[model samples]
Target: MSTFGDIFGAMRQVILTQARLDQLDVRMTRMAGDIDGLADGISLLRDRISRLEGIIEGAAMAASRQQRRIEE
Candidate 1:
């Protein structure tokens, strides 16, 4: 009878452990998706910043050209 009880207890523990693992898997999957979305957002931000930098460089060049003409 004692052996039977031990076996049943072990089975119960295993079931609980399996359930926890499954829950963890679901959470990990969701976290991965969230990370992917964040990466995409960061990429978009980087692209916009690059575009802005280009625009600023162009403006600076124009200003310099204008200044040189004025000096002439």
Candidate 2:
């Protein structure tokens, strides 16, 4: 035979569990969004760096050609 007080305590515990679960869900959502933003930023930086590398390599190749001509 459960008393009224015991029933009230059980309900309070169930409510607390639900509240904590909701908080976790919100935190996970924010974290997922932040991770996506970071990934996008990283991809943009990679593209810029690849372009810069190509430019630097072209300049180096042109300089080498000039040096070879001078040597000849």
Candidate 3:
């Protein structure tokens, strides 16, 4: 036979567990948003890097042409 005190204690434990779970859910949601922001930042960096690579390649080609003309 379960005593009333035991039943109330169990109920209290259940409530506390649920509260903790809710807190975790909120934290997870915030973390997901942060991750999304990071992903956007990474994408922007990649685009800038690609543009810089193109500029560097153009400069290299121009230098090569100038060198060939000088050697002629």
Candidate 3's residue-wise lDDT over 1-72, tens digit each?
469889999999999999999999999999999999999999999999999999999999999999999999
Q: How do the residues 1-72 of candidate 2 rate in per-residue lDDT, one tens digit apiece?
A: 468889999999999999999999999999999999999999999999999999999999999999999999
Clashes of each: 0, 0, 0
lDDT for each residue of candidate 1 in 1-72, tens digit (9 for 90 to 100):
999999999999999999999999999999999999999999999999999999999999999999999999
Candidate 2: lDDT of 33?
100
Look at candidate 3 and tell me the lDDT of residue 68.
100
Candidate 3 lDDT (Cα, whole model)?
0.99
Model 2 pairs whose backbones collide:
none
Candidates sorted by TM-score, best first? 1, 3, 2
Please report the candidate that would top lDDT against the real structure: 1
**Please, what is the TM-score per model?**
0.92, 0.86, 0.91
In candidate 1, which residue ranges exceed 4 Å CA deviation?
none
Mind sharing the TM-score for model 1? 0.92
